[model samples]
Target: MQKMAVLLSGSGRTLDNFHSRIQEGSLAGEIQVVISNVKDVLGLQKAVNYGYPAFHAADNDEINRILADYEIDIICLAGYLKLYSPPEKLKRAVINIHPSLIPSFCGDGYYGNIVHRAVKARGCTVSGCTVHFADENYDEGPIILQKTVEVGYNDDIDTIATTVFAAECEAFPEAINRVNEMGIDFFWDRVAK
Candidate 1:
């Protein structure tokens, strides 16, 4: 199984869900490292409980050290809110999950519940989640997978969040599977890997 390091700056529900999949044999991989930029993140404890190495990376040097120590194949971001500048050697190896479609409901202050609120305010008929490669920019990368959720007339911020969250719980694993299974492919008129 391939190893992946998850980086999240918030509650860490994504990591917890992945752990469950690992136990059930739905997802296969070792969580070599769990790096949270925030010290007080509750998800850190979840990693510790599962006996995965967890740490707080305060700066670029620290980030490089952690990534090196783990020999991680991919750095996955799940609700991590910090600006992460991967070492030049590892930039191509990181990815992230954003709760909205790219170049759409994504930008500054457009994360967490803020995303749901904006979707409702805009009266969107549909909203969902996106898993994309991570780059220096915010939520702007080549899209890997997306799951759309219907937005009904009665939808509120909480309801929208719930709808997207469910998709996330599944989409994360699916996207990872796609990357590890098929890899990304492109061609002049066709693509494969």
Candidate 2:
């Protein structure tokens, strides 16, 4: 089974989703650790509540050391706001879930509710989520999976956000499952072109 270490900076909704999927036998992996950049965050509390090894660290070196110690196979950024410079060996193993279709309402300053608001401001007819490889840049990695949701004419930011989040809950785990099943080589090969 793949051992996952999640990095988060806000509520643990994504982590909670993963746990539920794992418990239901849909995800073939276990959360080995949860590292939060900020203390007193809901995500950290959830990790502790779940009995998972949880740590709060703002230093990259310390975070890297903790990741190495856990022998993690996958690193997931679930609402993690800080920029992460993962060790070279972990480059291909890290993935993040973005709230937009990517290359759209994504990049620096385009996280959380901001993305939804952007979509609304642009009057987009469709909006969704993307799960992709995590690179040094924000949401600029090769897309692994995208789940689109229609944006109704009257949809407000809250409605759009709710819709996109629902898609994320499904797409993120499916992307992880795909990576686990096909291996990283397949992912790289498919995106190489």
Candidate 3:
């Protein structure tokens, strides 16, 4: 089974979801460590509660060291707020789940409720989530999987967020499974020159 590491900066909803999947044998992996960028976040508490090695690290070098020490096979950014430019050696192992479809309501300053608000304000009829390879830029990398969710005409940001998050709960694990099946070589070949 692939050993995984999760990075988060908010509520541990996504992390919890992953843990549930892992425990249920739906996901072919184990979460070896959880890292948060800030202190007192629920994500950290969730990690601790689950008996996972959890820490708060603002430095990329320290984060990289942790990943190496754990021999993590894949790095999942659940709700990590900071931009992490993975070193070349680790690039193929890093992935992130974005709230909105890439190249849409994504990029810097687009996260959490902010992304949902943008989608609702645009009067969009469709919105969804994307899981993709993590690179130096925000939400710019090879797309692995995307799942769309319909936006009801009267749906407010909160409603839309709830709907999309549900989709995310499904999509993220599916994407991770696909990535695992693809193997690390698939990502290595697609890495930018």
Query: Model 2 scores what on Cα lDDT?
Result: 0.89
Residue-level lDDT tens digits of model 2 in 1-193: 7789999998999999999999999987899999998888999989999899999988778789888888888899999997788888888888899999988988888899999989998999999999998787888777889999999999988899999999999999999898889886677667655
- Of 1 and 2, the candidate ahead on TM-score is 2
Worst 10 residues of 2 by lDDT: 184-193
Candidate 2: regions farther than 4 A off? none
- Using TM-score as the yardstick, the better of models 2 and 3 is 2
lDDT of each: 0.81, 0.89, 0.88
Give lDDT: candidate 3, residue 192: 71
Better of 1 and 3 by lDDT: 3
Clashes of 1: 1
Candidate 1 per-residue lDDT, tens place, 49-111, comes to 999988988776887887887676677887888767887766766778888877678966778
Sorted on TM-score, highest at the top, how do the candidates line up?
Answer: 2, 3, 1
* Best of the candidates, lDDT: 2
What's model 2's lDDT at 140? Answer: 76
Best by TM-score: 2
TM-score of each: 0.92, 0.96, 0.94
